[model samples]
Target: MRYHFLSLVQIFLLTVTTPVWAAEQIVLNYKVFRESLSVEEISRFAQTGELSSSLKINFALARQNPKAVRQYLTQPVKVNPVFLDRVLNTPLGNVILDQISQVIHTPSQKADRQALRAALVLSARQDSQITLIEIFKNYPTSEVEVDGDRLESAYRQLRRLQTNIENLMGV
Candidate 1:
């Protein structure tokens, strides 16, 4: 009877431990890309330097916009224009930045460089709106403080960036 009780305790322990182990695996999967690198490699290439310049910029933008990230992650991956706009605008747009940074390198092949730059610009523009919406959602009171002149200037800059990206992508 004691042996039977001990076996039950062991089974209970294993069941409790199993989820912790599974969670660790999930975390590992998320961080695996970093693990493959040697310390020397990381040191030689500054984290930002390791990524393409465009990707670095995109990361900055994404860091600034978290809502987009949440929306993108939660949404289905269909190509709905409205959904696309939201995803692009949210911090989730940072995914494009992440992809570009992962692949971008100095002395990159010409084809790769061109493709990355085009993607960076497009993602930034589309995502910017989502980010702005998120900001508004979070801080509705800030709308009352809007300076018309500043708002116009910001909008112009955003439009210019979007146009430049479209031109580069020929889209």
Candidate 2:
């Protein structure tokens, strides 16, 4: 009886400690080429500005600047989670989310819209700010796939959305 109680307690503790879901790998898809990178590698680069060997090689193959990638990963766009949530629920926000989802989505391409919405809201709720890395980290999936060629376009879309939102708020 005592052993059964201890086993139950251990099970509860493990459940509480584990993350329900989070992106473990990022698959960058460019044309017909695809490369996978671990979330830890990206997060470390964002925090320390140091790229792993695999990342460096991938950047070279993709013709992407590590510095620029790091910049976007770390740049924080301040937002109010409540307001963000409201906007994201609107028609216009749905359009924007749909566009962004094309660039960043699940490996199976299922629930892309919903996953993007959750990632955006959770990222903002974490620090009242959203960064590309934060969104990637919060994505509720085991693997997140990105259209590497359309990455710049996606970033532009996000910036445009943020600007419009701020203008409307008179901020």
lDDT of 2 by residue, 78-134 (tens): 877777788888898899899999999998888898889888888887778888888
Clashing residue pairs in candidate 2 (N, C-alpha, C atoms within 3 angstroms): none
Error of 1 at 10 (Å): 30
Question: What's the distance in Å from true for residue 38, model 2?
Answer: 0.8
List the pairs of residues colliding in candidate 1: 68-90, 68-91, 68-92, 69-91, 69-92, 88-127, 89-127, 89-130, 89-131
Q: Which candidate is the best by TM-score?
A: 2
lDDT of each prediction vs. the true structure? 0.31, 0.83
Q: What TM value does model 1 have? A: 0.21
Q: Write the per-residue lDDT of candidate 1 for residues 12-127, one digit (tens) a residue.
A: 75543332111010000111121122222222233223543433443354342323322331222212233334434455444442333233312222343333333333333334
Model 1 lDDT at residue 67: 33
